[model samples]
Target chain A: MKMSGAQMICEAIIAEGIKTVFGYPGGAIMNVYDEIYKQNKFEHILTRHEQAAVHAADGYARASGEVGVAMVTSGPGFTNAVTGIATAYTDSIPLVVISGQVPLSLIGTDGFQEIDAVGISRSCTKHNYLVRTLEELPRVLKEAFYIARSGRPGPVLVDVPKDITGEIGEFFYPSEVNLPSYKPNYKGNNRQIHKAAKAILEAKKPLLYIGGGAVLSGAAEIVRELAWMTQIPAVETLMSRGVMGAKNPLLLGMLGMHGNYASNMAMSETDLVISLGARFDDRVTGKLSEFAKYADVIHVDIDPANIAKLVDVDYPIVGDIKTVVEKLIPLLKEEIRTERYQVWRDILGRYDELHPLLYNDSDEVIKPQWAIERLGELVGEQAIITSDVGQHQMWAAQFYPFDRPNQWINSGGLGTMGFGFPAAIGAKKAVPEKTVINITGDGSILMNVQELVTAAEHRIPVINVILNNHFLGMVRQWQTFFYDKRYSETDLSYQPNWKMLAEACGGIGYDVTTKEEFDAAIKDAIAQDKVAFVNVAIARLENVLPMVPSGGALYNMLLEHKEEK
Target chain B: MEAVRRVISVVVLNEAQVLARVSGLFAARGYNIESLTVAPIPETDMSRITIVTKGNKRVIEQITKQLHKLIPTFKVIEHEEMVEKELALIKFPIEESLSDIQVLCQAYNGGIANVGEKMVIGMVTDEPARVKHFIEAAKRYSPIEIVRGGVVAIER
Candidate 1:
């Protein structure tokens, strides 16, 4: 059947099993919006801002294990989607962003609402295409979906020129994409795999360093099995929080700049570091030469370029994480009672007991960590937690015990400021039956607070628990520790009344300033039939403890001192 | 043991300081590329680069990894189990050996043509490494000059 490019786009998304899309309509994309209205096949969520649309798509992708789709019009609409694209790119989320562009003939002449969407999104996206003709629409759509969901998943942009959307074409979705330039290697060399396995067998103290790629590749079960068989304690990066169930005895929590003291210490002393699906970010490895100095690193990643680029690896396996781990599982000989594993675990346990996370009663307002822990207790293992970046993000990483893969979504690599609100909307949309909550700080929420309208419009019923510390908590904490506590531009003054903000967005809102108030507010938010925001007024001076100061060793953490205040 | 050798063809952005970036990456990663050739695309703002490197499977994989990390590199393809070719034009002296050279060039997917008086140019285009071998073989005939084109590739 002959159809316009706009209609074909909706059809292609439907073919890929997409049931919903988040977007905001505008002039250049009115035709596409009209096509969407005519079919009424898929649900179109109207977000307050285009950024939220992209982020909601990202959240949907992470939760549902499918390509998240978002749409927007030209000019500012296209520009607003950039942050969301960058977030997806940094976290390696699968997103196919479709945006409307000005007419082809008027592209270079600065037509109405015309902007270089393709050029602006080039670096942030895995690949981008401008559909100038009806003939290119079908192939471009198919290729975008394929590239977005394939190896090392990331966002792909397809800018449909306004004139092309009106053109007619026989829409046929291709079953196979034959791009010679984009062949991703999914199998590691047998020799490299064997070498990695042999290194694991020979090492005295082996540690499994996990990251978001493990979850993306669906290698969690294999990773757990390998860790158990080898008796290696696994420490995850922030993005890899839920890849393995946190309750497992062999699991050490997230390790990095704001990671657990014990996990960092263990990483420092490990003799054999088996890193899976993780780039060696600066936060994870303090100094390249000093990182895992005593270890023979075995780096396994799907992207060959990342291997040995940052840190030297004795054994590098480039392939799908799950495939590589599954292959190596059989090759490794089961050594049940390795003394090294026991000794390392014992040391970690000692550190955990000595400097446990503390939040004793004080005259000040409610503590943010207390609120997070209380929420964890109320929600238990099933609740899906999404967080914005800051002290609250780190606290959630520490306090929440995620027991399933993809249960926790946060901006780990990029640390994007306003990720929580929109991400929560996407997560709730992806899994409507599951209870989804956005744990964000007051400072971070303002970055994309308009997304509350998205939740209200879609009736997603996401619980937004704002830890209102009245300051850019992470930066303040840094100034307190590293600098002389000058509080330079860290204080957020003239804050909006969150209750009023939530109510303005057509959602339930509550402000809690004490532990009792916090508990009641959380319970009430979860019970509310619509989107709810519970603002817990936390102590502004409070800091996220167990922090490793800049250039400091993991073992030399500056633990929180009650006497200092 | 005899060293294993392979020729790699790379398509990259043609701009100032791109060659330095590509070659610097290889040098920093300790990859010893034997023969390197680079030139601009005839009708576009892109360049084609051909590199000859010797190594086993592991070393080749390392070289490819380093090459892929270069920002200017558009694509990298190692000529293994693919149709590969290179072209060269050698200006030779007009002599009785012209007919013999023509027969040799034809055997390797090439032909000899007389361009001007006392100067006959023989051209041969084959697999890049094979072309290198041909150039060395033709050196015995006292060829006056030789110019080789950078390699280009297409997946089979």
Candidate 2:
């Protein structure tokens, strides 16, 4: 059977089990849009901007562990999607970004809306293609989905010329991808696994350092099992915040920059560090010379390039995290449920008690931490939570207790502002049965507030809990501590009336200034299955405490605002 | 440790944008490629690309690891110890004494490939380092032009 390139794209998408697509129609993609309209098989959610489209798709993928689909026209459309592409790339989110290009003949003719989409996005994209012929469309689309969802997943772009979409072609999607060079190593070497197991068993104080890989690979169960069996305390990176149950006694909070004192201290003093699916990034391994200085590291990750990149490792096992952890579990025959780690746990417990995460609990204003904590308790542990970058994001990470994998989503790698609301929309769409919430900052909400209109118009029903601080609180906190407190452009006093803005976007809005108001607003949003905005008025001077200063070792936490010594 | 020269080869599907993907990977990681050559096999739908880069052990390992991640990339061979050669053609003014230049080129396995009315072109194929030495020695003969192709390597 013969099909046009546009139809082949649609058929391929349907074949790949992709049910939803976040897209915006444009000049070059008019034919594709027409086909989409004709078929009406795909759920195309029109975002306000191309960036939001890709980000929404990324959020969907992160939430569901499936490839997210996105489409837009060429030139500015591709340019607008660049940030989302890079954001997804850095975080290893799987997304299929389809951009309609100018006709092949008019490609270099300075055609209107013709920009080199493939070349411009080459650096950021994991892989990209500019489709030249109609016959190549199915294979390109097949490869796009295959490459996007396979082996450390990332965004893959396929630029289709406008004419190709209309040109007739033979359509056949491959049952499996045939890229020999791209087969990821999925099983760990038995020798390295044995070595890692031996190291874990021998060490008196073992710390399990986990990251997004644990959650992405669905190895949370195995990780928890290994930690419990070895009686090893664990600390997670910001990306893997919720992999361990928040109430678990052995699981320390996040480590690195804004990590807890106990967690960072544990990392510093541990005799053995069993790194699982987490790269020792600069943020996590501050002052690399001193990071885990005393530990014999056993790092396991799928990406070989990330192994021993920033820190040395005693046992480097390259394989899928889930597979590796499964292999390592049975090797530890010695039961470590005994009190060998009593001293280590006691030391960390003391740190936790001495330097607890605290914020000014002034009666006059609602604290962001209090608001987050309030919602965290009311919302189920399995609720999907996304956050924009800044103080609010830190507050959410600190206050929220996630018990399930993929429950907490945020822009971890790129730290893009305005990621949360659209991401929450995507998450809610992906998992409509679960409650999805976006905890954002006053400064971040303004970056892509137009997304509010997308939610309202589409009835995405995401609860937007904006921590309304009058200043860019995180930057202001940094300036107050690092600089001479000469607050330059950190002031965001001229922000919009968020409640009114939400209402203007045709959503229900509430202005919560106190605990009572916040409780009512949050409860109301969770009760109703509609797009709800609750702007919680938080104090401007509130800072995320227990922060390890940039380039400072993890153990050197600055507890400046603590009341006790 | 100081950076050292390394030869790497990758076999990839003979398709458009494969080269761009390989080059883009290096560029994004800030790894510099000294020289690159690619050619399709006569009977197969695959191409072999050879690249020379200078980096320390860790950097070279990282480059190799990253090269393996490319979708089109089939195999990445980082030459631990390999036989390598590069070709260089040097054009000298016709009036210059050719003996010295010819001796240097002959030692590197080449004589004058061409002797024109105004210029004499000496071609040499040898180990990359020896080719470098030949080019340096031929520079004293008032060479007008020099063209060097990328290195090709095979494991010894």
Candidate 3:
């Protein structure tokens, strides 16, 4: 059927089964926006800024396991969305972003509101396209979704020229893509899977190092089952939380730079490390050469490049994490360990006791860790909690005790600040019945706090728990420990009355300085069926500890309060 | 293992600034591209990109694997067993003996592509190493200028 480029886009989006799209309209994208309005194929969310639109899409994708869609005008519009796109790129979230560019005639002439959108976003995107003619628009749009959601999922961009969106053309969506050289391995090699199973059974101490790929591939249940059947302990990276149940016996807490003592110790001491859908990022492996030195590493990821990028892999199973883990579960069932791991468990248990995840319980003042703990306790870790980067993010990742896959979402790779609130709104939209909360810091919150109006106006009721420490907590912590106390511009003392800011934005707000106030404020925010912000003033100078100093071994953990001499 | 220079050739859908995506991949990953060339393939909807880079076995494999990830990419050839040649053009004063230069170029499949009243242009088509050797060998002629193009290769 012949259709306008904009109409074809709407048709293709409907074909992809997309229910919602977040975007902001501009002159360049007016036609596509009009087509969307006419088709009524998607729930169009008008966000305050282009950046938030992408964040919302990314959050929705991560939380719902759907390919999230975001559209915006070209130039400044897509440039603003760069951070959000880069955030998804780093964490491997499946997202399709459609951006409108200047007309073909104006391209490269620096047309009004036109920058090289494709060029700017090329590196951060899994794949990107700039449609030249109407003939390619339908196929390009289809391929964008296919590329975004397949094979180690990441964000993909399709920049549509304004003229093409207005031009009429024949619309035909291909049933299948024939990317001969781009075929992704979803099924594991039988021989490698069996060898991994044998290695797991023979090893005296085996550790499952799961990452975000497991969550994206829907392999959390399989991962938990493998740990259960094999009686092997596992550790979750920042992105891999909630894969194992809180009560799962074979589970170690979050592992890496700011991870639990037992988890890092287990990673260092294990005989075999089975990495599931997780890249050996610098954060996870403190010092590449010494990381998991005692272990034979088996890496399982959909991306072959991730297998030995940072650390050597003894066995590489390049396939989808969920698929690989599902197949491994059966093979491992027959090869269950004959020897008990009680001794190994005992040592890790002792380590956990010796270096417990600690925070001074302060009744006189509010503690960031306490607030996160109380929030988790009140509404278990089952709620969808997204966090911005900083100490609060690390604290949430560590103390929340996540036990549900896809429930705990954050900007892990890019460590992007200003991502949480908008993302929480998106998550809430994705899973309306579930509670959605943005655990943020003063520094990170202010980055995109303007979105308060979007949440209030749109009735996207997402609660924001701001840890008001008046400083960039993570940077301050580093300076306090490493530097000679030359406190730079890390302080953010000058701030608005957060409660007033929320109230002015037509949202419920509360300022809590004590535990009682914090507890009550959280309850009030949850009970209120409206957008809410709870600003909890936490103790200043507090730090996230058990940090592996830069370039240090995995085992070299630094305590928050070091004993003198 | 020590790092060695490798030539990677990629065929991608001929599109706008696909070279940016091709070269950007290596730069973003901190993989150095010593030399790169791109031109449209005849009678096909594709362009061939040749990138000269230095890396160990693992790094080279990563470069090739990542190249396959780009959307426009249709094929990536690592040139493991291939006939490869890099062209270097030299401009020397007309005073230098054209016969002597031709003899040196003959060693590396060289020829005089252009001759002017003031200067003569000599061309060499050979393995990148031999081209470099020819350029060094022709230096005694005091060549005024040298221009080297990216490597182009075919399966052996």
Candidate 4:
């Protein structure tokens, strides 16, 4: 029964059914790392940086549907993990990050490598704790996990002082957490469900607005069924990429800036929007005053604060999306199904055909869209795709045929640049049998290029497909449009030889110029047993089109590029 | 739905950073907090925080929901029938008309609290709107310094 705080941490992790964690060791957290070294209960991935560790844990959580665990030491380590924590926080990913702090006696004296981490991360984290005593360690650990994986999941941080980890304690991990202030509603009210069902029955042109909350709550099957049963067309947000599946007939694709014409038009025309686990973010609501202007909204989310925060809702239901959808499913009669929405679907389908996502493909010089489409074809439904934020990310979202929940993982809210490679590594680790790929840009890949060595060391076999445009394509597109081609510091033409860089990092590398070479490189990369990087050269001046031009109405989209004097 | 002043009472666990967490949400979201008061509840390890802010019905609903979302917060009450009070202390020059100032303070349910050689300090506890009026009226006495406490509210 008597154990050191370090042992208690290990015991608690085991008790929580955590099989792996990601972290980088430091002076303050040495004792915990020592305990990690002694325990064989969980695997600890030693990342190149503290940031990547948290991101890898986030990816693991996203891919596995389990609460991710990560640890790092004080000061710089804690600060480095802030972006990853914020990224997970914004996306509602469940994560518990353990941060080692300075000794209790040396905390406020401005000792070496000491920062008010709990204070700094207070706003970003769902909840946080500064562990002062060894006795409360077990309970804190339990509550941290419980709060992280509960309703409207998010990242939680626990700052453990160095002295506390070294002190002896009696370890007792609680099976259940009982916080008087924290109880999440999981069931929808019957009357509200009835009201929503009635609204759906009356809505002739209803649209299903799906977001990451649906993905997080595992409401994909129910949502897809609801869309089909109700004959409602669906549109996905960036975070909810695969929830509606790429092949669904009712799916209008992503709806926002850079979203397809059909989806945006459908959003503009729909009479009712059933918002399942989706917050009406500014990006989704291009111009707030005109967004879904004629629509009655039924916003259902686990978080009460999200409902009507930006857009007013006619029917607001605060509960788990899956549970609420399940309750509402039984209320709908077969008579609710009719051909009333057929005309609406036809209108959207016509829009899709009129302004389809198009790009000119060349055999000599590979286009990013073509490359992503080819990659999607080669890596079918079985692969998990992660992408960094940029032109390539948008392309992947546009092209990848993700057919299931959690099949596509990316930083949606934070849009962290260096997210793809480490996330792919974590996804591969979570599901070793499945192939994992990071579709990255030349700029984003370099941000976390050091993690290539981590993947190589573990032989994670995560393929990094670089869409090498030699420039920040998204920013260049903006500069070309708004700034009159005054491209300031957006060019990365003078870059490292990626092949040599990958070779140096203990991974196989390929320099792909033509479409044939790109295809060959990807197939060969997947065939390899080690980490592989395929640097494919894409067209330099390509832009992600169908933009709303910031603060413009969603329906007012610039379909393609035009030369203007 | 027009912008109007609303008072909300939030009960939260007494912890080191609970106040920071509660206030940080408002600061981060650009929500306005006009006045805030915090004091521990008797015989319990909990504190009641009263916040007065200006928002429309939607914004006030969001603020209350956000406050309720905090892990340490136990209850958030936006009472329809409530009694609100604010305290204001004003220091006046000793040469001012003491009788007139005392009468004015009494009109606002208060009186002079201290008489020092250099100044006279008057205190008043009244409704927040009346407290505003009392401060404005005391300005005529050429007060040396004035301090106003945050509003605290309770359901009637």
The candidate scoring highest on lDDT is: 4
Per-residue lDDT of model 3, residues A165-233, tens digit only: 999988899988877657888998879988888888778888889998988988888888878777788
Task: Give candidate 4 regions above 4 Å deviation.
Answer: A561-565
lDDT of each: 0.83, 0.86, 0.88, 0.91
CAPRI quality level assigned to candidate 2 from its DockQ score? medium
Interface RMSD of each: 6.1, 1.4, 1.7, 0.7
Q: After superposition, how far is residue A293 of candidate 3 from its true place, in Å?
A: 0.8
Instruction: Name the better of 3 and 4 by lDDT.
Output: 4
TM-score of each: 0.82, 0.97, 0.97, 0.98
A1-565, model 1: which lDDT tens digit per residue?
A: 8999889999998899998899999988888998999886788888888998998899899988889999999999999999999999889999999999988898888888899886677667777777867997898899999988887899999998888898887988888886654667788889999888877777778889998899999999989998877778889998898777878988877887878777888889999889999998887887566788888889889878778767778898888999999999888856445565677778878877876656665556677778888888899676889999999998899888788788998888788888888888888888888889999988999988887777887788998898987889899888887799888999986788889889998899999987888888878888886788898888778777777777666666767655345
lDDT of 4 by residue, A332-446 (tens): 7565765878888888889999998787666667888898888879987889999999999999998888899999999989899999988888888888899999999998998
Worst 10 residues of 3 chain A by lDDT: A556-565
Q: What share of the true interface contacts does candidate 4 keep?
A: 0.92
Which scores higher on DockQ, 2 or 4?
A: 4
DockQ-based class of model 1: incorrect
* Candidate no. 4 TM-score: 0.98
| Model 2 CA deviation exceeding 4 Å by range | A333-338, A562-565
- Give the DockQ (2 decimals) of all models: 0.13, 0.75, 0.67, 0.88
| Poorly placed runs, candidate 3 (over 4 Å) | A560-565, B40-43
